[model samples]
Target: MKHRFFPAVAALLAFGAAHAAPCPRDAPLPSGFERWAHPGLGVAAWQESGTYQATLPLGRAVTLHLPDIGTVHFIVPPGGKGSHGPYGGMIGIDVPSGATYRVMLSGRAWIDMVQDRADLPSSAHQHGPDCTGIAKIVSFPLHAGWHVLQISGAPDPTITVMMSSTP
Candidate 1:
């Protein structure tokens, strides 16, 4: 087969580069995170070297960032209903209203994402992924803040959080 003259252009098309962004389908946290945690319903988290906690009220989404290693986690509450999910124990996060948040990271590994809808409730367990090379990202909507957004898992991975348009 013939190759394209532009190497960058060739790679982008070959790997669906245009679609690459902090998306739920794309796990932002590094792959080694699998060794730390996998994505799922209930309280999915990672324990590095710190602690965190928060409780979302309702119809809100919270975004947490671990820029130290390039990883972002969000806890969103699906409005109303049973909030069904594959698992449980995942912390309830409080999200800011009308806000767009995103996390960015790059590496190679696997991040399993699971969420609970208002119609279905998750099991209340921990889920995660095995990240590698510092690659991961997560994006979602927010309208409030939960007592959540805690550093529950990674007791100390040397993480940090950055808010969008902070006053």
Candidate 2:
């Protein structure tokens, strides 16, 4: 039992050490994330409300509020429903045209795009560039219209988020 535990503990330490450190707040972002380098707008997330209380703009970073995961009434159940994080919330977005858009998050979290009362499927996923402060980026094919961006299972109460259309 002791030998087994030692290996497990060593593996956990190695995993933690392998994780990249977050970039400084004032540091310049990589080429694809240049717009996120500036200060972001602060917005409160809505809980238990279907109404869109805040709108996330394209190409701009917003400091979004993530209410307690237990309190939010998501449009649809998140894929990361089993997340151990205590925070999550929903926001609104207006897709100007039918295109592929990337949703970038400052930390690990689950993202769902909902339109017409249905959850849109993600097209692609990737990790942020080294030392860019970005943790994840998920892309979804969206059409022109109002859509809901549901963020769930976030470890923090607030996170920096940005959306941009693929050029």
Candidate 3:
């Protein structure tokens, strides 16, 4: 009986190994995506539901640092230039009541802050066109608890998002 059980277990293992899926080594990387790093900020990103998701700690000094909005090339002969931003994504966060946070954006962006409560109006911020390629800092207050931040705009390889608490 013991010998019979051993054979059955071995056969199951072999079957699973044969059916295992192989990693997609030749698959192309997603467009508008780039590796990013920030010291002491505890930041990370992942793809979900056809969009990118990023999260970071919002300390007492809440500050969000985003990378620039894509790349720009310039020519000196006829004086020409062009650039395309990366795809946008969503960021989910929770803020304590009566806390204020500052967002440091690095390019043109449309930021929308919303909560589940229908009574609350969504907070929106935009910086671009007139202020392209420039780093802008905007500080705002939150009512606390969970909130979903929908950040849409040009994709940026070096965009940073930092949220720090206000004094």
Top lDDT: which candidate number? 2
Instruction: State which candidate has the highest TM-score.
Output: 2
TM-score of each: 0.24, 0.80, 0.44
**Where is the poorest 10-residue window by lDDT in model 2?**
43-52
CA lDDT of every candidate: 0.32, 0.83, 0.44
lDDT string, candidate 1, 30-148, tens digits: 42233222211122243311223423223222333322212333334323233222222233444446454432222221222222322222222222233222233444444444323
**Candidate closer to the true structure by lDDT (higher is better), 1 or 3:** 3
Which ranges in model 1 have alpha carbons more than 4 Å from their true place? 1-89, 104-133, 147-167
Lowest summed lDDT window (length 10), candidate 1: 104-113
**lDDT value, candidate 2, whole model:** 0.83
* Model 3: per-residue Cα lDDT over 80-111, one tens digit each: 12323443344556676666665545555555
Tens-digit lDDT track for model 2 on 47-91?
A: 525446578888898888677888787878887856678888888
Off by over 4 Å in 2: 1-27, 47-51
lDDT of 3: 0.44
- Model 1: residue 2 alpha-carbon error in angstroms: 25
Better of 1 and 3 by TM-score: 3
The clash count for each model shown is 75, 0, 22
Poorest 10 consecutive residues by lDDT, candidate 3: 71-80
